[model samples]
Target: MDTPTQHSERDRSSEPDTGPGERSRSSRTRARIASALSWRRVLGGAVAATVALLLFSSYVVQPFLIPSRSMEPTLRVGDRVLVNKLAYRFGAEPKRGDVVVFDGTGSFVREDLDANPLTGLVHGAAASLGLAEPADTDFVKRVVGVGGDRVVCCDARGRLSVNDVTVDEPYLYPGDTASRAPFDIVVPAGALWMMGDHRSRSRDSRDHLGSPGGGMVPVERVTGRVDWLGWPPARAGSLEGTGAFGGVRTPGGAHG
Candidate 1:
């Protein structure tokens, strides 16, 4: 025979002693762990995506914004152009009449100066996405002559001539002349003569003829060719190479 207090004690001990507070605390701890893991996964994915984008833009292709109207009518201000970084890679060279982007340091500009690393990184990333203006040393232009070709402006027909072959530029801005300034120079080996489609508004090779490198952009400095216009839903199309320079001969007399 057990006493009443002993019976009560035995009953209490037989039942589970877990309290609501303890279960609530344990649930909260598990929730925190799950949340932490989720955040880590999200952060890791973001980092990987950024790295992939940067690498693709640096090596394969990049987007460039048209900062000015120098290439207007063909490339308008605010227009975004996709540049093919590998266009001239693997022993290929930039052809005449191709719209190219290059670092104009030591040619267009007196010197090549880099921006602060942090600022440069930010701006470069933005510019690569066509969301910001390119560096001052970067320029976009058409290749009029390349490597040992004789380039003369304003022939008898008021046209630009390359290697004695007159070029009929259909892409020039409406009512704009081939060149208002007179110039005659033979493009040096491994150099290029660049010109703008909007002759009146652009300062191209002719503007720097007296400067160092004779205003000729080195072939090595060429970044890429403009292959597509990718902005403004109303005006998006491929920038195909034209036959304007088809009749011009290569430096070594090879058919162009």
Candidate 2:
């Protein structure tokens, strides 16, 4: 037997307690989503991702764009190659027939870069993204001779020979002679003699024979070895090196 006022009071007392704290909890849950989408948080995430990508591109693997026909029949213009930075990072050496990328500033280009710091940074960032051209001094070529090897162009059969052994190059472009420009030289220790598949069109170590470095690329300056073709969906495959030196003797006179 309760009065109307007493019943109303009990109803009010039994009502769910939706106070400021409950409201605050709901507001916090809603804010969590906004916080995740906040400009500052999103910007931080993007910056972290960019840094990781740059680091990976710098020291792990990098995509190099081919802008010339120097390696035609194998790599074409607009083809992108994945350069494996770890290929020679350890005690492993660059073997004959391996394709490699190196900085050619002093050896091939014969000019030092007086680059502005800001411009260099911007160019690096763009190059890492594959949006800008690699440095004008970057070069990709095949290893015709390694350290302590004698490289001679044009034997009796007009073929290039390494370590005094005639090399049968099957990867040379059609109708292209091993080399029309004759040369006889020994690769100094810790250096490499590079040539392009399209020797006729490429300005490789042969073109800088008389330069200060004797057209020799220092092993220390090698950036990485080209491992695979990355772009042009139809051309994706593991790139095989010119295996002409399998029968050639090593620098120690031991056949490898």
Candidate 3:
């Protein structure tokens, strides 16, 4: 009984009424998801960058804080220094006059043998601080002898000698004796004899002579060479080896 035009109108009116409302809802949901994903991606990239920087700083170059006056006039308390992690790489060993950092794991830092995990972490962090007692474990010293060199302290003139030549260490602190304790020893093969610039306050190779390794630091234990003093603007400078060593030759070898 309906007219043909009326029937057509009814059919058109029955079509689904999902207009802009449904589309807007869907678009909003999609936008929220995209924003979340973008933020996650950014955070992930930041974390990755942080990890890379830590790795490079830990293994390739390390920042060291001067904890004491042991290396004064060259390095000061609170000073931060950049150590070269690759100085002794590729068949090369530490050389005299080069300032170095080494691990005293067994040399001076005795293990608790029963410390809790937390305690161990604290100790490790303290060592990293580089500013406390027995600093023996985290030492920064100058290389006085390297493998087979005869190193003796205090000649008649109160000077230190290496391989029979009196090394004129102009870096020695004013009014400080080269060494107060008398020492005469032949550096073992693959080991080094080290000392500090501030010889008076530094307890270095001299203090470990009677210990387990005879105070000779193993070449493998050295972390790297202290190349730059980085903190305290007035004291910032490079820790260079005296070309005074250019004339000194390795034992039993022709001078290069």
Candidate 4:
């Protein structure tokens, strides 16, 4: 029989030899597998984050980029406002003096729609990030009169009045009169009369008084209430109503 030590050496040599080249290839393969796994994990995390952001923006709150100078003194162009999606939900309704974001589909725009789906998607994504203006039909203005209220522009004192109660609008842009255009209309039930702080530059209820819907934005079209200014870190804060309508009575002569 072969010596014990000799037998052990022979057994070691009998095993498949793993050369430096083979070892190097094995290491590279392991490294590639590890890198792929790391990349998959990273991709999964990114996808999850995007889904969460979309859901939150769709249901909870959305950042709205101010598109024009319509709401200027109070909300400037390039400013982003935080819209509370559930503000008018359930039994609640938008009150006078509240800034709101609504789709002006039938009231302001006439069947306006994005022609290209890809462009729409890109714009929508950018809008959600507050980097681009919202859809063309989207409007942001303050609620000047709610349902069942008689809104008149340019009273004897050159001030707007709601239900005959002259509103004190301290929020109006400097030197901008309440309204140069005279209008007298009773807001229909389940509708709102919206106007911008920068009345002179804004084309609001007064502009569409003769059109269908009579410049009335339906309550259902209101997407949310603007509750906060979220852009320009130095100017970020809650956008509380100025209580311009505090003295005004609700519909049917009810005081609140």
Candidate 5:
């Protein structure tokens, strides 16, 4: 019972057998680490993508939804337009006949008493993605006069005149007059006179003549130019600025 080979085999069997248990614990640890890393990568990627999109929308370009029929025949309700934020970022300025979007707080609206900061932020984000209505003070219209230009409605031929030059607005809505309200105002320096194509239904510069800023929108208030209509698939196209104001003369005797 005490033979040398028998004693060696008994000692080998007495030692703890831990190979399988150790291996199982090591495998589980590795799997948990891998799963954690994968989730972190996915979350980081999503956050980065969201930041990039917001930056692009704020600086390079922005999406705007048509809120009303003010610019009908040119833009329709529910249509989405891409505004070029950099259009006026350089030394260039907004010109006549250019369709522009601007903040009309001091010019078009006396005050926005219903604005809520939290709600505005949420609505603004949704609007930037073309999923909701734009801000209450945001407006889109066509430029009729810019900087020291005299704009008059219903000239001898019942057509709007800029700097005494009659403008042939072929973009006006069907059956809409040039302007039912008579107005004669000289645009101040660094200001713009905007109007909607549907003159009858639009309450534009002509409607706010007695309000503050004389219904003239400051150039600094302009957000961007509506460069393209991006929604409704069938109505998508570039919004080309017309040469209708080409013949109009500025105060300095140069063409506007």
Candidate 6:
């Protein structure tokens, strides 16, 4: 009887030992899982913050690069400017003298008429080649006429005129003609007449006369008003409209 009772006691001790070993291994696995989850949460948070910042910058104040000499003497090639997206948001339309970035996709570039798979591929590859777009492509220019201003080029003394006032464009490039082409048009309401400072080198509203919109940019197509030049420390400055435009008044009963 003593021998059988002793055997039973030994069996019970062995069973308890197995239970502790199994529990120890399970505890280690749970700790590892918790550690992995913590790392996952940390990575997700960082990614979310980065995306939010990009969204804010893109929609509120985007940074744009001057990729061509079309705006030379004002915005040089390779200079980066900051566009204020809110400039026209709060019941304000684009004002004369404000440098702006607009969608020239359909207005100037006919390729925009049809979505080309090739163009998309080329645009994607442009950065790799370090090349600018061909002429009459998307453009960044200054606003000369807004809403109802009558804009004509080459007044009697070779000066651009807005609403019968001769505009002395000091912003015009040194030795650059005010306008090589003669144009006379009453800017349609709800549209803007835009031109580049380097008139000879730029193809702005002057070049798109026969196109669908007749060179007049729709108010809704404007992306934002450019307020500052932020790059090339030497060329950094605010882009103020020439005083010439100040004297010209908006046509009668113009809406703000």
Q: How close is candidate 3 to the true structure, as a TM-score?
A: 0.78
RMSD of 3: 4.3
lDDT (10s digit) by residue, model 3, range 130-230: 33332335778888888888888888889877777777778887878789999999989988888888999888889988988788888898989999877
Per-residue lDDT tens digits for candidate 2, residues 142-161, read 88888889999997776998
Q: Write one digit per residue (lDDT tens) for candidate 1, span 115-143.
A: 58788789888888777999888899999
Models sorted by TM-score, best on top: 4, 1, 5, 2, 3, 6
On lDDT, the stronger of 3 and 4 is 4
Candidate number of the best TM-score = 4
Name the lDDT value of residue 243 in candidate 2.
64
Error of 5 at 144 (Å): 0.5
Model 5, residue pairs in steric clash: none
Candidate 6 residues 7-85, lDDT tens each? Answer: 9988888775547789999899999999999999999998887567556655787667787888878888887777787
Q: Candidate 5 overall Cα lDDT vs. reference? A: 0.90
Error of 3 at 110 (Å): 2.8
Candidate 3 segments exceeding 4 Å error: 1-35, 115-136, 233-237
Q: What are the per-residue Cα lDDT tens digits for candidate 4 across 136-228?
A: 989999999888998888877779888778887999999888999888889889999999999989988888888899999999999899999
TM-score of each: 0.89, 0.84, 0.78, 0.93, 0.86, 0.74
In order of listing, the candidates' clash counts read 0, 0, 0, 0, 0, 0
